[model samples]
Target: MNYLISALIITLIIPIWGLLIYFLNKLLYILLSKISSEKVAMTVVNYLTIPGVIHHELSHAALALLTGAIVTEFKPFWPDKTSGSLGHVNFSTRGSLFTRCLQCTFTSTAPVILGTLSSILLFAYAANNTVPFYILVPMIYLIFSIIIHASMSFADVKIMLKGIWALFIAAYIICLYFQIDFLNVIRLHLIAQL
Candidate 1:
């Protein structure tokens, strides 16, 4: 059915986009490195993606606090070649095992959630041609920048894996609470598109 196809497309969009961005970023770095020093290439890439880095770090910190975790340190932008990290949020997990797992998973995935929402809103805005050309240009750039850095780091993934089971349960509960029908929603979207 159209709805099932739409649902499949929606589910696969994030991972596909993440992989594409990852490879493109790596290729950009390699090309830049060939043309310049590694350090310079890194610096250029960091500067280009600074906005997303800031958003990503802030999302982590925000979710940490929301989930009852204590954020001990927050760095929005600290490019460390040795660590290969643009920024980091150090949070102390609180609550029981379930709660802690939920906290870790939510905090780790905040960037992707927030970035996707942000991109969707920006795209909606850009779709409206009434916006001024100047504003639209920056909005498009910000959407691109946010999406490129929306993926979780390896360390973040490990942290999330610790609590992914809890996350799934919570997600399912939320869907139930909202009476969400993914297939219905997607089918409606498909109808609208047609």
Candidate 2:
């Protein structure tokens, strides 16, 4: 029962954590704008999150290409305060509506998926290996940083909603059903590896 509760908590927190990070970024951006120019605030945010932004845009581009979408514009670090977009990938969707919607949803949500996978690998690696204290600290920091930036921005979510929210929901449900103890599996795997 405790294990089940723990898994439930972990499952709930994953999405909520991403959303909290997204909203926190927005709030910080707004507050910073009051103290300085919007561009400066946005620049600061972008500068601080260069690694995440690069990963985000790369994932977007990769998924876009995989979906056969033409990525017309790709900006890894061009923050736009006016548009409230930290970085963007402009791609044209084609094919039937379902295919277009799936492509759009996948492209927009790739960052979170990839970031989570990266974070999991880092954690698992750290668990499986012995490292010096200093190195371990930085490794832990990197994992946290990846998680912090793993969430899609409001713009990304909006694009996803415009695509096919139902499809995404159904996919999520299917994944949930098959991986009800996903967190526990990760925990167990780490334990075994350690």
Candidate 3:
């Protein structure tokens, strides 16, 4: 029972945690603009994005190359204060949208998603077929990583409002369907510890 509740809380917090980071970036951007020029804030966004963009695009390029496609050019978008770029990288696709999208999704999310899956599988093996372990450890790690990466690379007010709102609504529905009391459980256990 405790494990189930804990899993629910962790899952729920994942999205909210990502949202908080998104808000924090905007807050910092606003403060930087107040102190100096908007260009400075713009510069900051680009700086933050450089490494992330490189890694993400590298993943895409690697995938395309693996598929034996010609990656003609890769251009990481030059950062500017006028636009938000955590360093944008483009892969010149050499195949159908299906292949490109597959590469894109795998490139963007493989580390976190696959890593979490591995962690879950490990826990499952180690825990000796415990039901609670089936639900808890993997979910906590998976959602936590999702929150981290999503916050860093995905979440933003600049993103589509409909998409963001829709995802949130869907996630809540998922939680509800699983009969999870996420917030209350977290407050009692995890939040207090924090």
Tens digits of lDDT, candidate 1, 1-194: 44334434543453455456666777888999999988888776677778988988988999999999999999998878798899899999989998999899889877877888888988987796588889988888788778777777767777877887676566556556665567787679999999
Q: TM-score per candidate, in order?
A: 0.77, 0.64, 0.38
Model 1 worst lDDT run, 10 consecutive residues? 2-11
* Model 2 spans with C-alpha error above 4 angstroms: 1-17, 24-45, 132-138, 165-194
The best-first sequence of candidates by lDDT reads 1, 2, 3
For residues 131-157, write the lDDT of model 2, one tens digit per residue.
Answer: 889999888877765665678776777
TM-score of 2: 0.64
Clashing pairs in 1: none
Q: Which candidate wins on TM-score?
A: 1
Per-residue lDDT of 41-62 in model 3, one digit per residue for the tens?
7665435344434444454456
RMSD of each: 4.3, 6.9, 11.8
Q: Which 10 consecutive positions of candidate 3 have the poorest summed lDDT?
A: 155-164
